[model samples]
Target: MISFINVDCTFGKKAGIKNVNFTINSGDFVFLTGPSGAGKSTILRLIYMDLFPEKGKVSIRNFDSSTIRNHEIPFLRRRVGMIFQDFNLLQDRDVYENVALSLYVSHYKTREIKNRVYEVLNQVGLGHRVHFYPSELSGGEQQRVAVARAIVKEPVVLLADEPTGNLDPRVSLELINLLNKINQRGTAIIVATHNYALIPRIPNARLFQMEEGEVTKIT
Candidate 1:
């Protein structure tokens, strides 16, 4: 449901993606693997329209980066979820509040928001920590909160950049397994990371390797 056609986006003299082309179908699980500056994160940004292509275009369903207006970006975002290496949970807010904030912004009813937040937190294995602050959770638990926050809105596609970068290997594997489960339930997932070792853990996932901002292989 997402396509990047001959896309070229550059941020500076030596940083950005070039001639990147790919398609992610619905319910698909894909991995973007390469070293730093290989344009993995750039590809995710393009999908979410955080960075418009300098040439070519990015299309996610009906929304096209080439023609989408700024006001419509928020609507687009509601269908796409994103997580990062660093858990971006609100330090002062409890887990329940963090996940519910998205629904609140979208003006969901209070009862519906409560149900959705509880369901997602449980999906991420954090139902018991609903009232705990970010500081009270472990690294993995905090990242689970981040995942819950991202998926609470039931996004169509989830974009995760270096999601396992901050966790230990065991915790990273657990996180990957959790994401795989989410993918199985129909939401397409695209993860960008440099961890080749983790790729094997995700069976049937398509792998796209990059080098110097260009895709080098698809396996």
Candidate 2:
């Protein structure tokens, strides 16, 4: 569902990513692994259109980056879910409201929005925390809320950047399992992380290695 063809991204005449090419099919769970400064986050940014390549092309569900218009970004983003390590939730909003915000902005009917919110909240094991604010929950619980928010819209692809970065190993494993379950339900998942221990647990996952701005399928 996603492809990068000889893509190159440069910032201030310096290379950010070089000749990176890869394809992720629907229903696949992939891991993007590399050391610090290896362009892993750059790849995710490219996929999310936060940064466009200077050369070559990025295609998502057959929509080429060059051909995509600015007005189409909101629509495109709605089709892809992103989970960040920092748990980017609004502290003032309750968990349900945070997840519901996406659907509301997309103009989903109020009844449908509530149903979607409840479904994903239950999926993330955060249904009981629906009325809790981000600051009121534990780190793991907050991340769960973030996950619910990401999937509430039922995005076709899920891009996660260091999703377990701040969590303990046990919680990290739980999060990985949650992601696996989501992928099993057919949402393509790409997790950018340096945690190799999680890979052994996910036997069927594909691994992508990045170094010096180049990415390759190493496993």
Candidate 3:
């Protein structure tokens, strides 16, 4: 449900993505892999409309970056979830509060928000840590909190940029497996990572390789 048509975006002297083109179907699991500076993150940004294309356009369902208004960006974001290498949990808040932030912003009823947050946290294997602060959790648990925060709103697509960058290999594997489970339940997932070794773990996923900001291979 996402398409990038002949997209081109650049930053200063560094090349962004050049004439990049791809489509991610609904409920699909895709991996964008390449060396550093290969534009994998750029592609994710385009999908989320965090960066506008200098040329061409990015379309996610009915919203088009070429014509989307700034006021409507928040609405677009409500349908898209994102996770990062560094867990961006609120240090001052507990896990429940952190995940509840998304629903609160969307103005969900108090009872509904409580139920959704508990459900997602349990799905990510963090039900017991609901009241724990970020400092009280391990790295893996913290990332799980991040995942719970991203998915609590039941986003249509989840974007993860270097999600496993901070964890050990075992934890990375667990995180990917969790994401796969989420994908199976119907939310499309697009992960931008440099870890080629992890690609084999998700054998059925679509693979897109990039080089110098252009997609060099797709499998």
Candidate 4:
């Protein structure tokens, strides 16, 4: 559901991505891997419409990235879920509220919000910690909450940027399994990370390696 054709991106004067072309199909799990500053996150941003290409084309589903309207962004975002490297939780909100915030912002029915949040919490194995504050949870638990927040809307595409960057190896493996579960349910998964060890454990995941602002697919 994601494709980039001869795309290029520059930040002010420096190049961010150049001559990058790839495709990520629906219901497929793909990994974007490379060293730091290799344009992994840049490519993810392009898919999520956070950064538009300087040239060529990018299409998510039927929406073209270059010409997407500002008003249509919210609708687009609802179909694309992003997991930041840093757990971008609302510090003051409890786990339940943090996950439910997305539904609230979308103005979903109050009752629906409660049910959906709890359902996702259960999926992520965080149902028992629903009322805990962010500070009270361990790093892995916080990351699980982030995953719950991303999936509570049942997004068609899930993009994770260095999802296991801050966790122990055991926690990292658990998170990968969670992503795999989500993929099994038919959501397309795109993970941008530098963790090479974890890549081998996932079967049928294609790799997109970036270096010097260029991307090459290594299936």
Candidate 5:
């Protein structure tokens, strides 16, 4: 559902993807692996329309970077969930409130928002901690909360950038397993990670190895 066609997006003199061509089909598990500054995160940003290519084009479903308007970005984002390396939760808001904030911003009905938030939290194994704050939960639980927030909208594709960067090995493994479960339910997953060890845990996942802002290999 996403394709990068001969794209060259550069910034800060020398950091971005070059001539990158690939397609991520629906429900596929794809990993972007490389050292820091290798354009992995750039790919994710392109998918979400956060950054447009300077040379070619990025197409996500029907939203084309070449011609997409600013007004339509919000609509595109609703269908593309994003998880970051850092848990960007609101420390002041409870778990339920943090997850529900997105729905509220989208103007979902009050009752539906409540139900959807709880449903998603349960899916990520955070049903019992709905009332807890981010600080009250462990690192893994907090990350799960981020995942729940991302999936509560039932996005067609989920993009995670170094999602396990802050967790221990065991917790990171658990997070990957949780993502696999979410993928099984039909949401496509694209994870940009430098941790090569986590790549093997997901069977049949497509791997893209990038270098110096370009995709050097795909397996």
Candidate 6:
């Protein structure tokens, strides 16, 4: 459902990618593995349209980076979920409210929003943490909150940018397993991580090993 055709995007002093080409079908589990400045996160940003390619194009189902308008980006984002190394939860908002905000922005009804927020929180094993705030939860629990927030929209593809960067190994594995379960349910997953150790934990996942600013290997 996603395709990157000879995509080349450059920005800042170190954040960029070059000639990156790949296709991720629905329900596929893919990993972008490389060093600190390997451009993994840039790829994810391109997928969600937070970054645009200067050369070639990124195509995600209906949206194309080269031709997409400003107004259409929001619709593309609703179909693409994102998680980050830092759990980006609002300290002022409780877990339930944080998860509900996306649906609220999408104009889902109050009842539907409540039901979906609860459903995805439960799916991420955080059902009881609904009333908890970001500071009250552990690092792992907070990340689970982020996961819940991302999936509440039932996105077509989920992009995780070093999602386990702050968690311990065990909690990281648990998070990966949770993501695996979500993928099995038919949402494609693309994780941008530097941890090569995580690759073995995921079965049958495609590996896109990047170097400098290019995809040097895919296994």
Q: In terms of lDDT, which candidate is strongest?
A: 5
TM-score versus the correct structure, for each prediction: 0.98, 0.98, 0.98, 0.98, 0.98, 0.97
Q: Check candidate 2 and list the clashing pairs.
A: none
lDDT against true structure, model 4: 0.91
Q: After superposition, which runs of candidate 6 have C-alpha atoms over 4 Å from their true positions?
A: 12-15
Cα lDDT of candidate 5 equals 0.94
Could you give me the TM-score of model 4 versus the true structure? Answer: 0.98
Clashes of each: 0, 0, 0, 0, 0, 0
Candidate 2's error at 20, in angstroms? Answer: 0.6
Write model 3 residue lDDT over 105-141, tens digit each, in one string. 8899999999999999999999899999999999999
Worst 10 residues of 5 by lDDT: 9-18
lDDT of 6 by residue, 144-185 (tens): 999888888889999999999999999999999999999999
Cα deviation of 96, candidate 6, in Å: 0.3
List residue ranges in candidate 4 displaced over 4 A: none
RMSDs, each prediction? 0.8, 0.9, 0.8, 0.9, 0.8, 1.2
Whichever of 1 and 2 has more lDDT, that candidate is 1
Poorest lDDT segment (10 consecutive residues) of candidate 1: 11-20
Per-residue CA lDDT of candidate 2, range 189-217, in tens? 99999988898878889999888888855
Candidate 2 local accuracy as lDDT?
0.89
Predicted structure 2, TM vs. truth: 0.98
